[model samples]
Target chain A: EAGVTQSPTHLIKTRGQQATLRCSPISGHTSVYWYQQALGLGLQFLLWYDEGEERNRGNFPPRFSGRQFPNYSSELNVNALELEDSALYLCASSLAAGQGKPLHFGNGTRLTVT
Target chain B: GESVGLHLPTLSVQEGDNSIINCAYSNSASDYFIWYKQESGKGPQFIIDIRSNMDKRQGQRVTVLLNKTVKHLSLQIAATQPGDSAVYFCADYLTGFQKLVFGTGTRLLVSP
Candidate 1:
C-alpha cells in the first residue's frame, strides 16, 4: 500500500498571500493530520480531520485551517502567510481517530515565504 | 496544559555505539507515546511506540521504554550508524482526540 503522499513537494509565496497544500492518505486510512515543522523546531500540530469532520486543532491561529474529504485526503490552507510560515508542512494518516495508532507521514510540502 | 519535552538538545555518539534519547511528558493521562526520526528536509518517520500499559517495545534495532510512574520515555538505538543521525521527537497521544503532542526533539549525530 502507498504511504501518505503530499503534493507540490515545494511551494513559494509572498507575504500576505495564501498557500494551499494537499495530502492523500494511505488506503484504508480514515484520519488525516497536518503538522508544521519550522527550521530548528519540532513538529507543531496544526489540525486533525477524520471522517470528513474537523476533530481537533493545535494552538495555531485560525489562519491555519484545513479539512478532510470523504476519501480521507486533506488540504491545509495558510492564509495571510507570513515570512515565518516558510517551513515544511507535513501530512500524516492513521487507521482511525482516537485509537492511538502510529501516524504515517508524507515527505511534506516545503513552503517558502518570500 | 500538556506538554512533551526533551532532556537534551543534541546527542553525539560514535558509530557502532548505542544512543539513548529521553523525553518527559507532563500529562499523566497520556497513555500512548511514539518516537519519530526526521531527517533534514524531510518528514518524521515512525520509529516505535509504547503504550502506558507496557514498559518497553522493540522494533528492528530500535527500542522504546516508557515509565508512566515518572512520566518519562526513552528511545534506544543499538549499534547506531551514520544513517541513524537525525532529529528524534517523542510524541504523546491525547486521549479523546486525534492529536499527538510532540516534544522539541533531540538531534542525534553519529560520528564515524
Candidate 2:
C-alpha cells in the first residue's frame, strides 16, 4: 500500500515570504496532522484536520495555518516566514482522532527560511 | 509546558545486545503512548504502542513498557542490529485531544 506523500521535498524561503507545504494521506485515512521538527528539537504539533474541518491546533501563531481537502489531503501555509521557521514539516494520517491508531508519516518537506 | 521527554540523548550498544530506551511523560490523562523510530532524513516509523489500560505491548523484536505509577515509558529492542541505529521517540496522547506530544528522542547507535 502507498504511504503518505508530501510535495516539494525541500523548500527555501526568505524572511517575510510565504511558504506552502502539501500532504496526501494514506488511501483510507481520514485524519491529517502537521508537525514541525526543528534542528535539535522534538516534533512540535502544528495542526490537525479531520472530516474537512480544522479539529485542533498547536501553540503556533496564526501565520501557521492549513486545511484538509475532501479527499483527506492537507496543506500547511506559513506566512511571514522567519529564520526560526526553518524546519522539517511532517504530515501524518491515521484512522481517526478517537481510534488511538498509529499514524503513518510522510518523509516530510524540509523548509529553510533565510 | 509539560511534555514527554527521554532519559538520555544518546545510547550506544553492541550488535546482538539488548537495548533499552527510556522516556518520562507528565500527562497522566494521556490514554495512548507510542514509540517511533526515525532514520536519517526519514520520518518517524511506528515501532509499537500501548494503551493506558495496558502495561505492555510487544512487536517483532520490540517491546514497550508503560509504568503509569511513575509516569514512565520504555522501549526494549532485543538483539540489536546496526540497522537499529536511529533516533527513537516516545509520544503520548489523549483520545479526542487531537494532538500527539513527542519527546526530544534518544539516538541509539549499534556497533557491529
Q: Which candidate is the best by lDDT?
A: 2
Q: Evaluated with DockQ, which candidate comes out highest?
A: 2
lDDT of 1 at B86: 94
Candidate 2's TM-score reads: 0.95
In model 2, which residue pairs have backbone atoms overlapping below 3 Å? none
For each candidate, what is chain B's TM-score?
Answer: 0.91, 0.91
Q: Could you give candidate 2's per-residue lDDT for residues A1-114 as a string of tens digits?
A: 999999989999999999999999999999999999886668999899989999999999999999999999999999999999999999999987664788889999999999
Candidate 1 residue-wise lDDT, A4-106, digit = tens: 9999999999999999999999999998999887766678888989899998898899999988888889899999999989998999999887746999899
The per-candidate count of clashes, in order, stands at 0, 0
Stretches off by above 4 angstroms in model 2 are B1-8
After superposition, which runs of candidate 1 have C-alpha atoms over 4 Å from their true positions? B1-8
lDDT of the candidates, in the order given? 0.89, 0.91
State candidate 1's DockQ. 0.52
